[model samples]
Target chain A: MVTLEILAISMPISVLLGIALGTARVYGNVIIRGIASAIVITFRGFPVLVTLLLIFFGLSDFGIYVPPFWTAVIGFILCSGSYQSEYVRGAIRSIDIGQSLAARSIGMTKLQEVLYIILPQAVRRAFLGITNELIYLVQYSSLAFVVGVPEMFAVTKTFNSLYFRPVETFTTLAVVYLVMISVLVVFFRGIERRLAIPGIELTTK
Target chain B: MNSNIPVLKVENLKKSYSGRIILDGVNLEVDKGETKVILGPSGVGKSTLLRCINMLTLPDSGKIWLEGVELTNPNTDINKMRQKIGFVFQDFNLFHHLTVLKNVTIGLTKVKKIPEEEAIKIAASALEKVHIPNTLWNKYPAQISGGEKQRVAIARALAMKPSIMLYDEPTSALDPQLVGEVLQVIKELSTAGMTSLIVTHELHFALEVANELLFIYNGKIVEQGPPEEVFANPKHDMVKKYIASIYSRKG
Candidate 1:
């Protein structure tokens, strides 16, 4: 339940942030591009656990108090957003340059080009990577236990300590995660198939 | 500006990349309802010249006038100006995600801000002009033949009702069998009095459609005159050689 809540909160935030940052990196002017690059590099290079610790513990020393659950949410968003942005950026760049010129020749503004022409195609190309990111988010939700969020793994640990049935408790927890992740994989595969472009595979190969 | 002012005028246009000159001291004029065909060997700055007219590739230094508006001026509203000048690329740069009707209607609704119903009416008529059957209107570009794709591209441009159309090798990318269909649409557009500047390698089509033919060599207009005059009495040695080579290849 706790894992689901965090995933629900963080997934949308990460996706939106990823798109904005990715677009800025590609199309923004020098200053905005530099800033977006800095953010992506910082979050991607730092460990998610370190990011959580900084937000939850280190910031309290400076008179800033963020609750443990929100800290985990923020950390996941920051880390996943950076990775997702790279996926989106790669997808956007993969589109032919002629697409932009075609839009411009028709008098569509830069914003209109991105919104109507570029983004729809780019999102289609980036769909599989985005689905993989969601799965990673689900597994990484276990890290929330370090911040006292009592997510799935943390709850399992508490149950095992009290009942002293380590083998059975851990087995149930493993099965639960497997089932949840397997369901996610199946659902996203269906979406990929449904939205597939005819005569054109999404694979880079 | 007088009524006799050329619909499109380019003067002293120059461009270079990596210190290599692409177009140097090029000039052109297209009167309203005139069809001018630019003929040249490959890599002779023909494509660059067309791109400059629409500002798709900005010229290094030039004066471009469309309907007497100075397009090279920094303060000019380029987007609005571009709406009046339609361009068709050799590669048929259609939005793959959009169906043919949607592709034609996108500019009208998005940039021209025409209502959807009105835009559809306009787009349908434009597509009809290119002889793209109504059955193919809902199909994606990928589902169509290369020739159909080119016609759809032309329709997408024509839907804007541009004052002047620019075509960059409209037939070069097609299979030989498909070339005639695309060229036929262009010929119809010419007969219908659409002002167009075309870059093409089809010597026969150029002779048929061009009111004036321009032969460019090494970023310069080496010969330009009525197609019959230039073909029968070539003044430049380079133009003569180019003509000979094309005919010999066909022979």
Candidate 2:
């Protein structure tokens, strides 16, 4: 339930941040592009464990504090959002140049072209990449245990220690993770079909 | 609007890509309701001229005016100027994700900010003008034939209610059998005084519909006159040879 809580909250935030940064990197002016690039690089450069640790402890340097669960969630969002931005940027570049030309010829401003023509196609094409990111989020939620959040891995560790049956406990953990990923894959596949366009490709893979 | 001022005009238009000149000092003017057809061999800057007039391909240095308003002025609002000119591409360039009706209405709702119900009504009439039947309104671009796709592209541009239309080899991409249908639509539109500038290789259609025919070579209008006069006389060697080559291919 705690894993679901983190996933449900952080996934949407990460996806939203990814879209804004992706668009900024592609279409923004020089300063905005530089800022977006710096954000993506800084977050992606650090290991997720280090990020969580920094968020949990580093905020104390400024005389502010965050709980372990919230820190884990924030860290995951920053880390995952960087990768999501990369996928979104790649998808945006894949749309043909002619699409923008047509949009401009129809008197659409640069912003309107991106908003109406480019982003809709790009988001659809980014669906598979986003779904992959979501799958990773499922596994990364386990990292919350490292920050003392009583998520699935923390409970599993307690159960193993209490019963002294490492193999059974760990094997059950693996099965549960497999089921979680499989359910996500099926859910995304249904939505991808609904979003599919006749002549456009969402993803080749 | 002054009746004497041309609907579209270009002065000293020039452009080059990678130091290779595409348009060098091309100039022309089109009054309201005048149809001028430009004919040239491949890569002769004919399409570039149309694109420059539409400001799609920005000229390195040039001037364009629409109804006496200077479009090439640095301070002009380009999007607003573009709204007054309709451009149709060779590949039909319809929004592939949108259905045919949505394709026509998108510019209306999104760019013009017209309400949805009114945009649909405008789109319906525009589609009808291009001879697209009611049954195909919901079809996707990939689901339709090349002829139908071209007509839908025309309808998309026509829905803007532009003062003048620019066609860059609109029929060049269609199959031979499908070319006549698109040409017929262009002919009908021109005859009804749509005020168009067309870049095409279709000699018969050009001779039939054009009030004036221009032959461009190496980024200059080397030969131009009434369609009959230019075709009947041998003023420029390039024009004469170009007409002969096309005739040999057809004969």
Best by lDDT: 1
lDDT of each residue in B8-48, candidate 2, tens digit only: 99998899999999988988889899999999899999988
Candidate 1 residues lying further than 4 Å off, grouped into runs, are: A203-205
Which runs of model 2 end up more than 4 angstroms from their true locations? A199-205
Full-model lDDT, candidate 2: 0.91
* i-RMSD of all predictions: 1.0, 1.3
Candidate 1 — which pairs collide?
Answer: none
Error of 1 at A3 (Å): 1.1
lDDT of 1 at A59: 93
Model 2: per-residue Cα lDDT over A1-205, one tens digit each: 8888898899999998888888899998999999999989999899888889888889979888899989988988898998899889998999888788889998999999999889988888887898798789889889998889999899999999999999999999989999988988999899998888876555575
Residue pairs of candidate 2 with colliding backbone atoms: none
TM-scores of chain B, in order: 0.99, 0.98
* Per-model TM-score versus the true fold: 0.97, 0.97
